[model samples]
Target chain A: MAAMIERINVLIQYKDLLRELVVRDVKLKYRRSFLGYLWSILSPLLIMIVMTIVFSQMFDRGIDNFPVYLLTGSALFEFVNSSTHMAMYSVLDNSALLKKIYVPKYIFTLAKITSSVVDLVFSMGALFLVMLVTRAHFSLYMLLIPVVVIQIYLFACGLGFLLSAANVFFRDVQYIYNAFTTAWMYLTPIFYPIEMLDKMEWVRWIITHLNPMYYYIQHFRDLVLYGRFTDAAIFWGGWLFSFVVLFIGLFVFKKTQDKFILYV
Target chain B: MSEEYIVDVENMTIRFNLASEKVDNLKEYFIKLIKHELMFQEFLALKDVNLKVKAGEAWGLIGINGSGKSTLLKAICGILKPYKGTIRTVGTIAPLIELGAGFDMNMTARENVFLNGTVLGHSRKFMQEHYDEIIGFAELENFQDVPIKNFSSGMQARLGFAIATMVKPDILVVDEILSVGDYQFQQKCYGRMNEMLQGGTTLLYVSHDINSVKDLCDHAIWLDHGVVKKSGLVEEVAAEYMNENR
Candidate 1:
């Protein structure tokens, strides 16, 4: 407990640097593009359009609010996918600064995640517009969306810490993660309903029970598209999985951080 | 444990593992791992090092390449964790190990001043309070809006130097940063450092140029092969190091 408190204090002390790093990430990301912040919204909208056109006719079951369904899955999954990929390079990218001075090492990962969260927030604006166009109802349960967002953030942050630390020692972790996310996306049932695989219930059960992103994305769709909370089992399971991954991420990052300077 | 010793290092050791061969991808690494073919050779960067720096004392570290001078400075600055000992630092530390290290090349000079200032742990309000002073000192009044990538290396160094030293740090770790920039700007930096020294900031400086060490330091240590070969008054140690190297 004392160690946790001390770590929090260290984070509080370096808050300004963390803020600056996040700002730099956000600014540099959009600086080269002509549309700047608009790309955050447009890119996802464009993807949703392409995927909806490509997959709608084949997989559209009796699902209501198909646009919101597609938007929620793609937006939230992109949050985890792109955020973790960016976080993997956070420490290695700042090797020059790491060798020069002492700042809390985790700040880099946290900053990268925060920048992605900013992009995610902007994309939420696009989600709201889609909800209006599709005439989706906003229930009181929609307030629960914030809770789901926090869970996803924690999940991404945990993976961020773990991947950034590992990448410092092993340069190939980035490529491996790229391949992993591509396969993982198909397994998560982003564009189609799991019932389409009812013939393969065992595969559906594995995806539903085992994959954390399945839980996160499912909760997101429940709150936004279905207008309700996930069942108690899944709600608590998602939170538990997020915290466990966060625990492991912090554990590995703290244990291996001191050696990062030597490796990088 | 004395109150006057602002920097204390005792029995500190730093070791690095250099991988024997190139394994660029994880496939090769995993193959080596399963076959027990992975190998690492341990390199001791600093061995059983002990040092103390009192408040207001300016010390120079003189050494040939690969003698662990920069490693010692980094250890003091808390950049590298020591393998086997304790380092107790009593005050705020600013390490000028490399100039413009935290900069984003696409940002304008004005933006990086704030960015670098925050990276050095200064608050936004603190930067706001000293922004003009930093610009004035760097002589970058006209180049504020220009992207730093377009600036010459010396100009970037000047901006880095100006922001880093704008406030008096309680303990400063400088690593060969003064050797860059034009001669006139170099003299100006030296002048500012002298003023800071007069104001009682403890300084740990590492340099290859013996003349600057002799002129700027009151005490010195000569490190050779990861150990301190000689340490004492600046003149005595400088003479010993010069005689040995020559």
Candidate 2:
């Protein structure tokens, strides 16, 4: 924990460096692409449309403006998903940075986590406009943004540190990691509301308690769409899990950082 | 009996575990993850190595490409850990292992220097205050605003080396980075080392340049297969290492 605190101080000290790296990362994907920034806005909208159609047809529920529901889930899940994926590879992607520079290793993941927030912020703006037109109430729970972002950020940073280390020695993690995200999405209560999980109490409880994404998305819905006030239990659960994942994630990265230069 | 010692490395060895798959593919990796048994084939990069250098001392590590010269430098800087033994250093340590690392190529030269300097452990205030001196040292005043991606590797090397060595650390770790800087700048670097020595900074330099080793180093160590094969005054140690290699 003392080490974690020291690393946090390092991140704060080098905040500008992290910001510069985040800007470069965001630009690299956009600049390399033909469409530039439009890809960020368009891709999520496109995925939401396809998901709405596909899932509506599969579930036989006529999709009932499922576009909005799918948009919310997609928006939230993509934020978490990209955050996690980037966090996992942040160390690997910045191996040169890792090898040469002597700062807290977590800053790499922190940069990724911050970049995920940027992506989230961009798409969520578009999501907000759509929700406004569709008459979804903008509840005060939306103030939960700061708290929820921390939840996702902590979990992402934790896994980012963990996966980046594994990636150094194992080349194949980047690929299997992609598939894991897809499967991981279904495990959380994202596309469908939690009420839909009424019949399967056991699965519902696990999704709520065990899945970190569940808290991330649920926290958002509780404040944004659901109109229900924040629950003490969910808030604390998310807080605790975030720190735990963060603790182990950073520990693994620091312990393994030395070996990366050799493996890479 | 020499009383002064700035860098002390005691019996350091580093071993790396080689995992099974050399190629990266999703299918094979997932399969291996499910197997529950991942055996690490191990190899040692460095073996028992020991040395001590005091304040104002300039030393060089010389070896062939595959020898653990870089590994030993990293160990001394505390960036790497040894499977056995201990490494101790006094004062703030800065490593110039690879020039232009942690530098975002997309950013302007000024921005990169700021971030790079910060990672190298200079405060933002210090970077700001010394900003002019830094640009002057790198000699990129005309193009400080330009992105480094557009610059040549030589330009990048000049800028990075200038920024790293700018700190004037008590203990400075230099690898083969001098090779990247051109002839004039190499002389400049030699001059810079002399200035640091005047200011009382200990130097640990690693290079293939026997001439530079003979000229700049007070002491030299010959590393062969990660062991300190020879250690003594620069001429004798370098002569022995160069003869053996030749």
Candidate 3:
């Protein structure tokens, strides 16, 4: 308990540093682009357009408001993708400063996650624009979006801390993660409805019960598309899964961080 | 004069275990692990070192290249963990090691000031309160809006030094970062260090220049091959080191 308080005190003391790093990341990310942050909204909108043209004819029948569904899923997943991938290299990238002074090592990962989450918020502009185009209904269930966002954020933070620490020892982790994300995208049913997988009932069952992103994404779809909360079990289950991954992430990060200076 | 010890390092040792054969990737490493082919050779950067620094005293570390001067400083700054021992320090630390290390080359000098200041654990409000003072000291008011990449290395070093010293830390760890700047800026940095010293800041300075050490520090330690060879009055230690090396 004392250790936890000390940790929080450290975080509080360095909060300004954290804020500055996040700002630098967000600004540096879009610095050279002519469109600037517009790209954040545009990239997802463009991906949704392409996916709509390719998959709309098939899955559009099964999934209502297919564009909005794809937007939310892709945006949420992109948060995880960019956050984890960027955080994976945070330690390696800041090796110069890390070698010079003592700043909490996890701040780099936290900074990466903070910037990616801000980007996710910008991508919401694209999601809402699509929702307007589809003339989606407005309801109080949309208030629940923050809950889903928190789940995704915690889950990404967990995975990011885990991957960033692992990458310190193995550069190959990045390449492996790149391939893993690609496969992970297909399994999450971002483009197609699960009903489309009728022939593969076992795959569908596993996705429903086992996959974590499925709950968060489905909760998003439930709120934005169908205008309702998910089953009570999935809602609580999503939070549980998010915190569990977060716990493991912190555990691995704290365990491996002291040895980082030696390896980095 | 009496002394109040503010930094204590007790029998500290730092060891690095280097892989004998480079395993290029995780796959190769795991393969080697399974086959029992992984080999490591341990290198000690510091061997059972002990030191104590009095509050507000300037201590210079003198050593030849690769003699663990920088390693010892890093260990004190908590950047390098010792293999065996404890370093207890009773004050906030600011390190000027590899100056401008936190800088983004593409960002303007003004932006980097805040960025680097916060990286060093200074609050944004503190930086805001002292931004002009930092710029005034760096003499980069005209170039504040320019990207640091375009500045000469000396100018960048000046900015880094200025930002780091904006707040007087209780303890300052300086590597050989000042040598990159011109002689004029170097003098300016020395002036600031003198002022800081006058205000009761303890300094752990590492430099190859014996003259600067003799001029600035009252006490010195000469390290050779990962161990302290001699330590005492600055002039005596430096004179003996210079005489032997010459």
TM-score of 2: 0.85
How many backbone clashes are present in model 2? 3
Determine the backbone clash count of candidate 3. Answer: 0
Tens digits of per-residue lDDT for model 2, A1-264: 997798677667777667666776786668657888877778887777777666776553633445566666677788877777777776676778666646666677778878888888878776776687778778776876778877877777788778877787776777888998878888876566666778999988788778888877767667767766778888888889889988997788777776676666
Tens-place lDDT per residue, model 3, B1-246, is: 113578888888989887776564798998999998786678888888888899999999999998889889888888888889888888899999575688989899989999899888888999999999999999998998899889998888888898888899999888888898888888989999999999999999988988888888999999898898998889899989999999
CA displacement after TM-score superposition, residue B245 of candidate 3 (Å):
1.1
| Model 2 ranges off by over 4 Å | A1-13, A27-29, A32-68, A197-209, B1-4, B17-44, B242-246
Cα error, residue B232 of model 1, in Å, equals 1.4
- Model 1 interface DockQ: 0.68
Better of 1 and 2 by DockQ: 1
The docking category that best describes candidate 3 is medium
Model 1 lDDT per residue over A1-264, tens place: 998899888887788888888888889888978999999999888888888888888777756667788889888899999999999999999999999899888999999998999989888888998998888898888888889889999999999999999898888888889999998999987888878878998889889888998898889888888888788877998999899999999999999999888878
- Residue A18's lDDT in candidate 3: 90
- List pairs with backbone clashes in candidate 1: none
